[model samples]
Target: MTEDQSALKTLSEVVRDRRLQLGLSTRALAQRCIDPGTGKAIPRHYIQRLEDDLANLAPPRLPELSALAAGLELPLAVIQEAAGFQFHGVTTRHSESGRARMFVARFDELDPAEQDRVLAMLEAYTAVKPPKVD
Candidate 1:
């Protein structure tokens, strides 16, 4: 198969798998893909078509893909990669464990009181952050 066709198949499979892994229905997933700027959810039919591999539907635009990433709790790079874009820099992206290790390096250096403050600040941030679309 051609590269683009292979990528399209990959994207289709990934989206379906991620949605199922997250226990989301197509309608729910579509709701999560709402345009932040326009406040419009991606058409549920379109998501279904993509997942079902119906012909003639366009590849999702960057914004829609980004929304899907946020909704699916996946890194944007994963979706981008499945869409056939090769990243040139950094050889590979850092894993979640690597990110945690980096975070600990700085967090561990802080004093106890500072650590407590930071934890409290993070808690506040979490409380105020927008709720994920259900």
Candidate 2:
């Protein structure tokens, strides 16, 4: 297991706090979000439910997750990480700190062709690893 890379918060708090930080009303947040997969605007009522009672709600699917990330103006990885830990009750070793971590977190945003190239690069690079410098 990896050390915590960020402070823990429930998905509700993550969304609510970020929304407030952006000075967005719940409706405004919802208005700004659309399911990336469907290209449909997310309902304001759904946003309200998420902020008000996320614990009782099923974890959002991938498209909604993308929408929330856009809405919150956070990387999709941050939202995914929070949701994964909070709802799935598990965390990932792949989730790391610093630039490398951010690279992996945003990796999913890449297209499949790009992902293949990245994976190839990762494998080639890691095949000749040097020790980290302090």
Candidate 3:
């Protein structure tokens, strides 16, 4: 990443890591990332540019984002949110873990009783002793 990239999980990092984790090359990823809007494969160079953190590149639209998410075998919301935070400066109450982040992101939209129930369940989970690590 460039010197200016934030420490938070970024679109660039997610794309690169997921691609590598799946043993896909840029060309393979591009072949999978077919833009639904145009039914055309996203160019390999575009995928490379995204992984390279090319400055001033616009945040991908929903179609590219959706294709990328599928190409990486990840949820669209996760990729979309990461892209927003990385490229658009979207403010979020950062969580150390992705599960916590997902919960926090949607928690505010829940009804009061629903939120209370979720918190209660969470408390119960925490109250149980975790298995001892060797």
Model 3: CA > 4 A from native: 1-7, 36-38, 93-134
TM-score of each: 0.53, 0.76, 0.62
Worst 10 residues of 2 by lDDT: 1-10
Candidate 2 differs from the real structure by a C-alpha RMSD in angstroms, to one decimal, of: 3.9
- Per-residue alpha-carbon lDDT of model 3 for 1-134, expressed as tens digits? 44334566889989999999999999999889975556766788888999999988888987888789778888776787779877997645546666877777577457689999999999999999799899
Candidate 2: tens digits of C-alpha lDDT, residues 1-134: 23564556656778999999999998899988876767877688888887786567888888888899888888888888788877886664553447777688768989999999999999999999998899
**Model 1: per-residue Cα lDDT over 43-95, one tens digit each:** 78877887886657666776776676767777666665565432211123346
Compared with the true structure, model 2 gives a TM-score of 0.76
Residue pairs in clash, model 2: none
TM-score of 1: 0.53
* Residue 20, model 2: Cα distance from true site in angstroms: 1.0
